[model samples]
Target: MNIGVIIIIVISLISIAGFSRPELIYKYQFNAWQIKNRKEYIRWISHGFFHADWVHLAINMFVLWSFSKAVIYYFMRSLPGNSSIVFLVFFFSAIVASSTFSYFKEKNNYNYNAIGASGAVSAVVFASILYDPFRIIYLYFIPIPGIVLGIGYLVYSRIMSKRNVDNIGHDAHFWGAVYGFVFPILLNPSLLGHFFNELLAIF
Candidate 1:
């Protein structure tokens, strides 16, 4: 199985197991205060494995699978022999990078908690968008260009993060998407110009 599919399977199994064992869920779930107070730093990476429920897990795994193919293709073309390793780095880094803002923001909030693969999935999706900017994407059953959806996603996440009413981690989505979009370019700077050329080609 490809790394993306492997990840989905691994996460699904772990999440299902965690769901049945509340103690496992509590042990791995992201609690910013726990990291700040007890030095339980593993939560930064571990939280990505557990999720709120099946629907959350399904959505995240589906999105990660959907975009990972393209992102992996681009990585292979861009990074040659080290594609798989580099892609894995990107995926794992995004998980950590996506949570930094929240960790700092809620580090003192004893009640704050988060879970799910949304951040890492967002990273995969936005990274795919960077490679195929003009591809069509459905947003709420409405088709929009990939680049347009990327911008809209970031905007919505930013606005929602400030509102902070929903249980969803808009901050993670925002930061993960940003990390996904940028990490590849940092790995292979040539992609930056390629992205612009692809965008300009659309006009």
Candidate 2:
């Protein structure tokens, strides 16, 4: 794993501990991580690791692992404008960005707390989509592939978010996915050999 992913895993473990240890977690750890205000938004950056349950951790980390290869592989290639570090900056930044976006918009909701690596994980998955929209990716037991399902989920999240369904942060997930899909194209439109040559030439 890259530094970005390793750091995220470590944070996720710590967040899990904090979430499970209410008294100790709060006392020893910074309270800002629980989705606080501008003064505490720094916590939002690290808050993606904390999960509501074991199931959440398993799913998020599993997806992270599954998709990390494509993202990291794409990022490791050479290109103009520092393509070497493309995925790291985009992945980690998107997580923090997504958290901040989620909190920044819903701060007034009072009950709008956030957690999980879905924001970053979604970025990885959506990045895959941008790379190859027709690629197949199974969701749990389903085998519909990611493009169809990913687009479907994006729309679903937006609709459900508009409806304000339950406690879901659909906006964060959607926007995170959007960032994942966009950053790659914007940074390196070539996306491969020809794209790389043309992009590098511009720089």
Backbone N/Cα/C clashes per model: 0, 2
lDDT of 2 by residue, 1-203 (tens): 46546755786667678665865333332233344544654555555656667777777887887777766666666334444366667767887766555655665665446666688788888887766565678877777756688879899988987898586668778888888877777767666454335434546
- Give one digit per residue, the lDDT tens place, for model 1 in 1-203: 77888888999999999888989889888899999999999999999999888899998998888888788888998865677788888888888999999999999998999998899899998898888888888777899999998998999999999999999999999999999989988878988899999988857
Q: How far is candidate 2 from the true structure (C-alpha RMSD, Å)?
A: 5.6
Q: Model 1 has how many clashing residue pairs?
A: 0
**Which 10 successive residues of model 1 have the least lDDT summed?**
79-88
Which regions in candidate 2 have their CA more than 4 angstroms from the true location?
Answer: 1-5, 23-38, 78-85, 192-203
Cα error, residue 195 of model 2, in Å, equals 11
Residue 42 error for model 2, in Å? 0.9
Task: Give RMSD to native, each candidate.
Answer: 1.0, 5.6
Best model per lDDT: 1
